[model samples]
Target: MLKKLILIALFSCSAHALDSNIIEIMQYLQRDSDLIQRGFFLNKFDIVQEGIEKHKVDFNTLQKFNIDMFLDEKHINYSPIISSFLRNIKENRIALEKFLKDNDKIRAYEAFQQLDYNCMKCHALVRGW
Candidate 1:
């Protein structure tokens, strides 16, 4: 009976840990999404240079966090939204990278505008953000 109780307690703790990790991952993803959307808007509208500056920090924060580990089988709550959001981020990053590489402010600004619209559409249809 004591052994069974110990096993149950261990299982409970493990489940809780997994839940917390999944929540953290979700929070990180949400943060990145919000930042990217805001940055794109600020850059396109030319109204909030500060927001674009802040987004650089947010991107660095995302880089600091290890997202791949939470994508394992232990976190069974994964969905299409996760993959879709990741892909969107990647595409946005690539657009920005290309803009920077060419030093073409006009193209960069236009890409950001498109990215902003895409993010909004996805949020409205997918996560209801």
Candidate 2:
């Protein structure tokens, strides 16, 4: 009877650990999605802004988070759809960063267009839309 109780306790602890890991994974996914949306909005503002004053809000928000934080492995999933989504986000970010550093609005806008398409594609693929 004692051995059975010990086994049951061990099983319960293992199940809890598994549940925690799953929750952690979901949180990471949510964080990545939020960051992507924020970046998208910032890039949009950068394109639309006619002057520094028009961009101040987006610029401040962008500056609040280290972009690198969004590029971590937590954003990726083993599934093909999720993997592609993450890869596209990373590529788009690189392109946008380069364009921004060069002060090239045209290229930045192009990159933003591609990023928007990627977002739609990922959503349709994942959500069956």
Which one wins on TM-score? 1
CA deviation > 4 Å runs, candidate 1 = 44-96, 103-129
Cα lDDT computed for each candidate against the true fold: 0.57, 0.55
lDDT of 1 by residue, 16-112 (tens): 7766865665466456546645655565433234434455555455545445444556433443565565467557656865785587766766666
Candidate 1 steric clashes: 0
- After superposition of all CA atoms, the RMSD between model 1 and the true structure is 6.3
**Per-prediction TM-score:** 0.43, 0.42
Residue pairs clashing, model 1: none
Candidate 2 residues 1-129, lDDT tens each? Answer: 999999999989876665565446445544544454455468654433332222233333433433333333653342556556556755775686678668886786576567657757765654557
Judged by lDDT against the true structure, how good is candidate 2? 0.55
Candidate 2 backbone overlaps, count: 0
RMSD, each candidate, Å?
6.3, 10.1
